[model samples]
Target: MHWSTLVDAVVVAHQPHSADPARYDIVLGAGVRSEESLFDLPAAPRFELFAGTTVAAASAGRCSAVDGLFKPRADPAPVPMELIGCEPAEPLLAALRRPRRSERNWVHLLVLDRHGAEMASRTVGLAITGARPSVLGGTLIDITLTDGGDERPSLAARPIWAQWYQGPPAEPNLWAPYDTQGRAAWLDLTTRAWRVPAPRPDRSGGEHHLDGRFVTDVPGLHCAIAEALLGPGRYFGREWNAFKDCLCGGFGVAPPFTLTWHDAEIARRALADVVEDQEDGLSYFEDIVRLLERYGVTVVLR
Candidate 1:
């Protein structure tokens, strides 16, 4: 598909590479870079961030009218962009020359498609928007400071969970935030094709010099959850255990945090392992759901 075909929407003026601007500070600018191939599509997408999201701008004037507890202000910062699926990438070259027609503004971005349908969207994150490694279209944005994206230079060095069993992950240790099938997947507009090394083994069986190929549980789910927790560096031994931590406490999501746990017929029987069979009460997992509500975590049991 053409690179533009892949995008659903563009939310500009975001903290470079940060999926959650509310949780992370915004870099004043995140350099965007893009390039094209004669036979293939542009390596990545590109757009410049402005002052704020349209959502924030719409609310600005209304806030001043609050009667009792209110204050008037100028240049109120834009509400942080949602990072549900986007982050910052490497900056375009330092000496970029933006087209005179391409101007920056103080607003959120959500341009519709030519068809007037919802556009394909990319999460606002760090991206390299340049034609070449050294050339830039404009003063590019930097994402090395964001915790889960290119804003933070340290992300490049983090150990991917796919190879946690090894001393360190294989060469080019980058964060693989998505689990497409069993292998780890992350967004990289630079590469000709988005492919990565195989996932680390989940177990070692009877004796063997080399590692086993089979993963103990669902590797993709684990990788996805790991990304949710900020890249793959925080892989634990088991996917289930890791999920438990997120479900109960050790992890967090955007506001109105909701967790849904599904149980099999066998899972219901396992309730014996938790609380004794309650004549009129909930199951073990259901009890956990109730407890989580006390912490303001909305858990839906299935």
Candidate 2:
């Protein structure tokens, strides 16, 4: 039987790559169900097991369980382009031309809690406009200064040649003066600021800097934000810890100063209080939901 039709949901309790053992808990409704272990599923790359039920009564529950296992898949759509005249045309053009790598661009992903047991996830990418590398692209530049105070013309011997010959046969005073080169020299040409066109209005949002002070009430949002700030590899480590930590209070490490963390006890007391105490009236988890809606983050609810 096709697992998708019978299974209402699949919850991956653990992943193989994880430091912890991988396990999945199959939840079935009050009806008969069957399962098949698959080496591969084209649409779900990570899944190793397939489950479902023919009983209609339990279908919804099974679907929910399956949906919970993986993060919602994203739509890879091309971004729309808009043309706007540059205000400070010279600097703006210069900034764009500066050598930079796009892959280094930073992004944030957050996972949040839904109901008591449910979770959600999202990702957000950030870019700093109008910034460029200080040095000319791939060019190595160096500088040297000669002291004119000496009455006699200074004869300088190259250091590399001197080293290869064991020592300079002549006086030490004849050695050439050294100079700074490449990236070192590039660091010296410093400026406070440059002008670039404002980021697209649609891309910009209310300026709320996320700091440690805010408490989170949603685990999914917390996970998503953690993924966003720390990147995928680190996020996975933090995520496993966060889930276990929620069951208990201490994360062993100090609370994350970067993204939000939900206090499960606080969430149990009152969600409103959890929301209000949150910075900007949104925990890192809730922010994930909002961000996903605007930024093409896929959220699949089981």
Candidate 3:
């Protein structure tokens, strides 16, 4: 009787890290078989044997000797083998023989990024036909970035050190060290003291600490010394009123002028003069706060 046979199989190949092109190793799976060859067999053979059993034995032996099959090298690394998928041909069951050449296959290559992110994957077609051993491989992929336009000016001075003070004091304080071209500078932390640079500018420098505490070396305390004398909102409003009174007295203006007029014409000029000296000082503290934020440091500002 004549019989029809079918075979199904999957093959995979990979190059080990230590493998060199001059020498290559190949691995094969047992289930691989050719459908045309299996169909040529008779339904009832003169002798009957199990094809699966024979294939299994061959697979075991091949896998065991795989390491020895490769050329010897300074360092030999063992490559793992796997049979991912399999199927059998019907008539081939009675023959109980080794796999014919056509049924093998391999997996596609995948590329990954530096962070282990998958960048791309593509199927690589086999070059040779009816080849005995399967081949597997991989290649590296690269990423590139483009620039966008927006330019800003650089700062003349850079901050080297900064710290936030959380201890109970008049108000929250920020300390910072700045490189100001050879100028005598005193930072009021607790009090003002000279910042001495060490003999080796890079290796050592004079250090000064500031806080709310009264230190003889430092000249000024961090807190506003005349808070009680000025009272709440007194400076802001008193300065405004004084300026308005002066303007009206000078212009010979009479009463009944609206508060809005006083604010726009006279008060604005007066307040500007009062706050002029303190503007740059306040900005120094703000710059320190900005630097700390840039460095991912959390700061409590009061």
- RMSD in order of candidates: 20.5, 26.8, 36.6
For residues 40-63, what per-residue lDDT tens digits would candidate 3 score against the true structure?
Answer: 333433421122211121111112
Model 3 is weakest, by summed lDDT over 10 consecutive residues, at 144-153
Better of 2 and 3 by lDDT: 2
- How does candidate 1 fare on TM-score? 0.20
- How far residue 132's Cα lies from its native spot in candidate 2, in Å, is 17
Arrange candidates by lDDT, descending: 1, 2, 3
lDDT of 2 by residue, 1-302 (tens): 24433333434343443343443344433222324534343563432332211121221222212543333445444332111222335433443454243223332222112222112212322222333233443332221111111121122212323232332122221111232221111111111001122322121222212222222334323323433333211121222233333223221122222232323333333334333222255533443344444433333321
Report the candidate with higher lDDT, 1 versus 3: 1
TM-score of 2: 0.17
Highest TM-score: which candidate? Answer: 1
Evaluate all candidate structures by whole-model CA lDDT and list the values in order. 0.31, 0.28, 0.24
Off by over 4 Å in 1: 1-163, 167-255, 264-266, 276-284
Q: Which residue runs of candidate 3 sit more than 4 Å off their true CA positions?
A: 1-282
lDDT of 3: 0.24
Error of 3 at 194 (Å): 13
Each candidate's TM vs. the true structure?
0.20, 0.17, 0.12
